[model samples]
Target: MAHLLHIDSSPRGDRSHSRRLTREFVEAWQQTHPADTVTYRDVGRQPVPHVDEPWIVAAYAPPEQRTPELWEAIRVSDQLIDELIAADILVIGLPMYNFSVPSTFKAYLDQIVRVGRTFAIDPEDAEDPYKPLLLGKKMFVITARGSSGFGPGERYGHMNHQDPYLRVAFGFIGITDITFVHVENDEHSSESLAASIAAAQAQVAQLVAA
Candidate 1:
């Protein structure tokens, strides 16, 4: 049975489309894989601490060479990394804020992407210095945008950084099998919002079954 990590970054409770879709995806996944386990983390409600100066020092320092104070500084990062490494499947709920992911989610990302833990750096090897430790993982992102037409070759495609940023960050840690289900037109008409929600629900159903 696979271990799934469900993370919601939307600040809005009932009004968030990404939040609703992620819940639906997890519920459907549970129905199909009843024996699988899930771990839920709501970064919007309970945000993780951003990395500070001490955190930076602790992260780069070798574990064997770290002092008690240094270890304490990076305790949370270690725990977050451990949880990420344990999960085989990840379901993330993200709403576009200022054309990108929420700051709370970005803080969580900074905490988990640690050196010598999630990734490794080998300056000696010129060909590939940065190595990804997390592999064979799958990610499903439920994204909500205020406007529509952000797909490839669209007018606002170049302006859209939400999905692309997620892809780059997650791909940096070796998670290339990522799928996005977008619920757009939130700032538009009610009918459009409903249609987008319906389409997202259909996509979630198909993905869970697959």
Candidate 2:
């Protein structure tokens, strides 16, 4: 059975669309694969610490050479990385804030995406210096936005950075098999919001079954 890492990064509680969708997805996933294990993290509620000077030093320094203070600095990072590496499937719930991800989610990303842990740097290789170590992983992102038309060839496509940025960042760690389920038009009419929620629920059901 696969181990799933479920993360929600929406500050809102009951009002968060992405949070609800991800919860439904995980519940359906469990029903489909009852033997699968899941680990949950709420980065929005309990934000991970952002990278600092000591964190930078600790991350770059070899594990064997790191001092106790350096090790202490990277303790959280190590735990986050270990959690990430243990998962075969990742489900992330993200709500677009100010046209991008929430700062809390970004902070969690900064904590987990570490060199020599999630990725490796090979300066000796002239052609390819940075190498991704996390491979054979699948990711599903459920995103919520206030507005609509953020898809490809849409009016807001040019202004959309949420999905593309996620792709690039997750791909950097060798997770290229990524799928996104977006619930938009949240700021629109009640009918539109209901329709969006229904559509997202249907999509989640289909994805989980598949």
- Tens-place lDDT digits, model 2, residues 13-47: 99999999999999999999999999999998889
Model 2 CA lDDT for position 59: 93
TM-score of candidate 1 against the unseen true structure: 0.98
Q: Write the per-residue lDDT of candidate 1 for residues 53-115, one digit (tens) a residue.
A: 999989999889999999999998888888899999999999998888999999999998777
* Clash totals, every prediction: 0, 0
TM-score of each: 0.98, 0.98
RMSD of 1: 0.8
lDDT of model 1, residue 148: 91
| Residue 146 error, candidate 2, Å | 0.3
lDDT of 1: 0.93
Model 2, residue 206: distance off in Å is 0.4
Which 10 consecutive positions of candidate 1 have the poorest summed lDDT? 111-120
| Candidate 2: residue 10 Cα off by (Å) | 0.3
